[model samples]
Target: MCTNTKENDMDIYEFYSGRSFDAYRELGAHVKKEVTGKKTVVSGVEFVTYAPNALGVNVIGEFNDWNETVMERCYDGSFFKVFVPEARPGMMYKYKIYHRDGSSMEHCDPYGFGMELRPAFASIIRDMDTYRFHDAKWMKNRSVCQGSPLNIYEVHLGSWRTKPVFDEQGNPLTPEEIAESNRVAESWYTYKEIAPMLAEYVKEQGYNYVEFMPLSEHPSDQSWGYQNTGFFSPTSRYGTADDLKEMIDILHQHNIGTILDFVPVHFALDGYGLARYDGTALYEYPSNDVGYSEWGSMNFIHSKGEVRSFLQSAANYWLSEYHFDGLRMDAISRIIYWMGDESRGVNDRAVDFIRNMNQGLKDRHPSIILCAEDSTDFKGTTKETKYGGLGFDYKWDMGWMNDTLNFFRTLPFVRGEHYHDLTFSMMYNYNERYLLPLSHDEVVHGKATIIQKMAGMYEEKFPQAKALYAYMYAHPGKKLNFMGNEIGQFREWDEKREQDWDLLKYPNHDSFHQYMKALNKIYMKEPALSAWDDDPNGFAWILCGKENDVVYIFQREVNEDKVIVVLNLSGLVYKNYHFNYENGDTMKVLINSDWNKFGGSTKDTEKTIKGVNGDFGFDLPAFSGIYLKPVD
Candidate 1:
């Protein structure tokens, strides 16, 4: 028998009916203290799950030696819950559900706050209020990113760093010891240990925010936290839920905001997960035709009200409980179109669900950001819901990323035909709030690293890469780059290994690293470069369509201060490249990618130049770019 019937309430029923956005706090495992006897207070946990189609349900866990029938359901047939005085925090548990066909299955809690590490799938009861955060200053000063320098460094936590092997005398181990230690990939740093290190690195790199590539609990390491089975639980591979909270606290103390890459479109297909709860398709679609996702996972049935409440509650739990600054929703293109295919026509049910969910989250936390990685030409993605839009704060500019990368991949002799790729982004720049991203998607699956994507031999890629980055920073919109891009790391990202840290020992790579630092510092310091990114007046083209020399020049202006950017894509140097510069009386070289410091050959040219009748000319280096600031 269950411990008590007096604690039964209508909250779980409301949750099942899709009315509770905070269902995470009401359903699942909630710890409560009850006065069982005089002068006696017993602290226990209440387990609630919605399994309306099940013949019977039982709460099984370590507290009862995996007993199957110790608990009882409530008065309502739609929900089942039990209060166990013996169920305390840190105990493992799962629901033993009996089907109408006389069969039974054990499934993890849909709203479990914690879960055991892989190879052990039981849910762990966690007290969410145990950790006290000290990020009041950051929280108080935080604002939604609008016309601010929002440069994000996206990282996969495990691959960011690994544990180092050491000898008995406390000296660093030899390569032989390292190879043996790293053979099985067993060494990993806990969240509490890696927090300060990651925060320090991000600050030194001059990024204000860090976007994690999904930290939720998943069974397989290869999925990189994308195939999540525990949406509400931080993966135990790092540490406990409190450990994750501590990590966030440390980053907040360093004044570095955290953005979580959230996956809401689909879930892992593990049997113990949400695939077939209550011996039926409770959280996902039943038919395989419309049920499965492109990644071979079950798709969420958004038309169901209960599923909508469940997904939104999980989203809110991250911001409210973990203190996350923002959410970069993954695979939003799937939510806009059926099976993520534009040819499949728009999915009306999923579209409505997105609008409703986004509006609800906005109502609760207006200062938190919601970014969508959608490639479709879906208008009003960044518009407010009241104005008949999807209500996202920012949308990934996939078209711009593809076009720019393809242009760089084209050889100089043929780049003239694709010159429009560089200028085409501005044609629809104002249609939505966009974020220019060179994300993890670009560097994986044989796509090659950012530097390797340049159209040249191994050594020639460096100069063009520097030119590409200069153009990206000078271009409009916020910025996001994957972890290894800044250091000119040539290897594609792998989930199992740390980034190539030793590459910095090389002179060319180290110089490229310093160039990135200078660019980031300049981006943060110059208001003319980032202050009015969304405003059309912030950018003006000084020169375009010079197909012969493959040269382009543009200016980013704010409050009358301007920085002119010039790019020469051809391999041939021009002794004199002339362009019309408005107010060119005091033109000075702000940054020259062709300077000797950044692994370039052009060092004899003068850093300062003067204009005659608003016309300025300078020695344009081959396969390089420069930023010129008009001092007047």
Candidate 2:
């Protein structure tokens, strides 16, 4: 039977009122040590769960030989708990919940810190305190990075780079043998094994942060960890919970921040998971019309206090326990309006829950970032909650992503008609603290890769692709690019195979890689590009209304330091083209996308040009971009 104490009653009140942010500490399987008057210590594990609708509950696991041990109900008749001296770390367990109709079902613990791999559905006992992190200095100095460069490299760990499979003789396995065996497990590198490799690669590539797709325990690899079954459990496919901790620790040691992709809207519909939990729709909405999401998963009913507490606690658990620097909340538009349809009216209950959760998380982790991946034009997504906003530090600019990609995909002859698509983003750039993303979503499911999306022949595509990237970097906002984007992979991203790293052997692809690396370096080193990104005075358009010329010129400035960007999207070159500039300032070419070294035909010449009487002239190559900075 469970021990009853006044402290437990208070915790239950807080949990049910949606006020407990650290509910994992009180609800899950916790290893405890009790000291007696004789100064000897007794060690045991205590299990706790909340199931108000259940008639009774039993704790059954390996320690008890899978036999049912009845749990004691607390005074409130909502929570059940049991203490077992025989329970040890690494033992698997589940709660057997008995419905009022005398039917019983075994369910994995919602707050379990570790879970079994797929095809298995048991929660494992894990010691969360075993791994000590050595990232105190990184943790202490971390911030939202509002005024600093925030170039992110988004990765899907499972397919980033798979390990080689070996047979029983310690030789590399043949293709037939790998196909016959469990290829999924054979290809994956554990979290600890991939830490150093990932750190070195990301640091070398010049990305300051790495945003991984959802890492929570899920049933389908195809879902990419979006449909979670265990909210608090890190998926065991990567390794044990401590292994994931070590991965984050290694990233911090390399001075790179880690951001977790969190899903707060839905859960997997697998029967063994949260579906009909406790013999009732406790976590999800009672009706299918509003309960099921468009992705065929259960929608969390945030109106329930218990549901809010469960989700908010799960969000807090990752940031507080795992040392993650930020959380990128996914599908926030679904939370703002019913079924993500603005006409269906706002989901006030869900919105309030979001506001409360965000406010609470910020109060707890003041320096950590809270980003929203919302597509709605819903106002104040990055505003403070006290001033009637959603309280996010950054919001993904979906408008900019769609518009810019559409412009690049148009044929050069017809690009004049779509010129405003590139300039439209600035009309509302400051609506929220935006992050410009070229994420994995844009490259998957027949959308084509970034380079492949260009509208031209194979040779013509390279220069246009180079020009597209130059324009993206010079635009206002934070930046994020998927793993394979930097290398100009022609093939779409596939989760089953590793990235086409072999593509680097080709001269065109290799040169594109070098160009991307150089662009990243300039972005990180220049203060004018990032230091005043959110300020209105940082950007100005010198040539926006000329649609027929298929040209764009803009100036990005921070105080006295300034840089001018010129882009030519047409097939015609403009020799000695003149544009208005600051008077008497000599301008030098910083980076030219059409240079021969970057797979272009432009020959090297005098790079510096003088601005006389507020006019600067330079040769603008076809389908090219160049950055010009004022000389001292």
Candidate 3:
């Protein structure tokens, strides 16, 4: 290696991916117990800190020897130090973690506010508590107490844009610059651009909140934000931590809340980062007793004190420094439960710790919302914390997604349609303190697209089924839609692939947009559809099981100016179909799925419907659903 530069010399080591694979993996757990990671300050190229487990971590700078490792890390509990071989501006370095168990790993900085896989690429050393600002200082001005009324728009950074790229390693890449190139085709976008654009779009579309997939840094180019490396930093590929701050500021300016999709369940086995900051034994758990996720990664030792510091710091940091309105914690089901244990994986101590986290965040900032993506039957997740709950404002109703998909998939033409199941979902989906979300998870990974999920007979069935999806929007619960769903995006989400933006030119695509806009009209405009969303009596329905078909009447707000949503789940069109409602002057048709614009020729123009003989009968199109507002 060349020397005579401005830097010193250091030892370099390597642990190929294929070398000691099992041992390498075991090290993730071992550190938590024996030599859990320890953080140390290092004066090397670029001025960065070194964690205890950094294996063969050495400094490489613009000066000094060009070796991979120089200024090797030396430890004294307070901090880790390295000469940086003469740390210089152009100097680059990488942390090398080797396990006493003979396993090795490499990764980027975990606490870095901005980071690259290796060094010299630039990384921000962010201490969450280091920042000082009091913007949303008086959160009490807002009447929305935690879960008063929150409608979230979930987004994934890599897929939300239309540009894509690949790295030298054949890894899928999403460089953040595509946001400004304005290339809505096969590209990635930067935070500086995406924030303003998304805020304006959501403000116009009438959504109150924005939920982003994980923003943490990671090495995998195509990662769906699930595999994380820099827990304390925003992905550098997007922009600096300040860019995210600017984005959130814009969102707040628009009165749209910001929520981060957080993954505290596990940590990526990054070799160059926190994994082996001090030594292999330093932050990680002692043995394999700590579980591993089905997906390849290191699980957090939730019960450990140091682990608690790391995780809690992460949660509170985002809320305070970034001004995030909330956090949607991913995978709570895996946190305190074991697979197939019937939700019996009870870790009371860990559960209490999570509750304490809620108190800690709110104690500092009372307005922060904490939501969970929990699918288990845990009873106290949403109960008041005073009652010994986990203190989450709400838990996602994952069962409803399953029930809805199952009902839609079993088409009568293919598999005999089951009306009872549909009624069952309607009856129980919103039973608990919950939220309903057609999350991004459901639309990808070889599962048929949402439109395809509704395909029954013809491409014609597409819009008809979509009409029912509109009904879902008006359902009595908090509503959430992935980024592209509002415009009827036709492609499966691929981290490496961009959205098919050209599809919007088609009339069908345009119609999907109009259709969704109409549903949101009811969702955002009507108090009956929103304010009382968590109240069940606010949503009551009656199903008349016809011999050849079924008809259901959904009523919102009894003894008041109310809306009635009727679904005709049969193949035949019926005129004067018997339906009864409290005596009202007439009824106005708000929306009908059977329209020529929406790939349907059965156009039913808006009209006033009347009740006859204590029964309101109206023309029902074949396989159609309608939302009607009872008029005076």
Candidate 2, lDDT over the whole model: 0.89
Candidate 3 local distance difference test against the native: 0.61
Query: What are the models' TM-scores?
Result: 0.94, 0.96, 0.79
Worst 10 residues of 3 by lDDT: 24-33
lDDT score at residue 27, model 2, on the 0-100 scale: 84
Q: What is the per-residue lDDT of model 2 for residues 302-381, given as tens digits with 9 covering 90 to 100?
A: 98888989999999999989999999999999999998999999999999989999999999999888889999999989
Q: In model 3, what is the error at residue 347, expressed in angstroms?
A: 2.8
Q: Which digits, one per residue and each the tens of the lDDT, describe model 3 over residues 1-632? A: 12222332111111111111111111110111113367543333232333444434443323444445533333222223343324432223343444455664444434445565322233433323333433463334533333245678888876665435555576655434343343323355777778777888787777888899898776665556777777776876676667778778777877788889888777666555555455643445556555456667666766655556566767766776688888999888766574214445686655765776676666776667778899887777876677887878778888877776776666645323466655665665454667778888888888866666664654645555565675676566677787777666657766655566667788777777767666666666666666656667677775445535655668765336466777765556788787677666588877777666665666646556777545777677766667788776
TM-score of 3: 0.79
Worst 10 residues of 2 by lDDT: 1-10
**How well does candidate 2 match the true structure, expressed as C-alpha RMSD?**
2.2
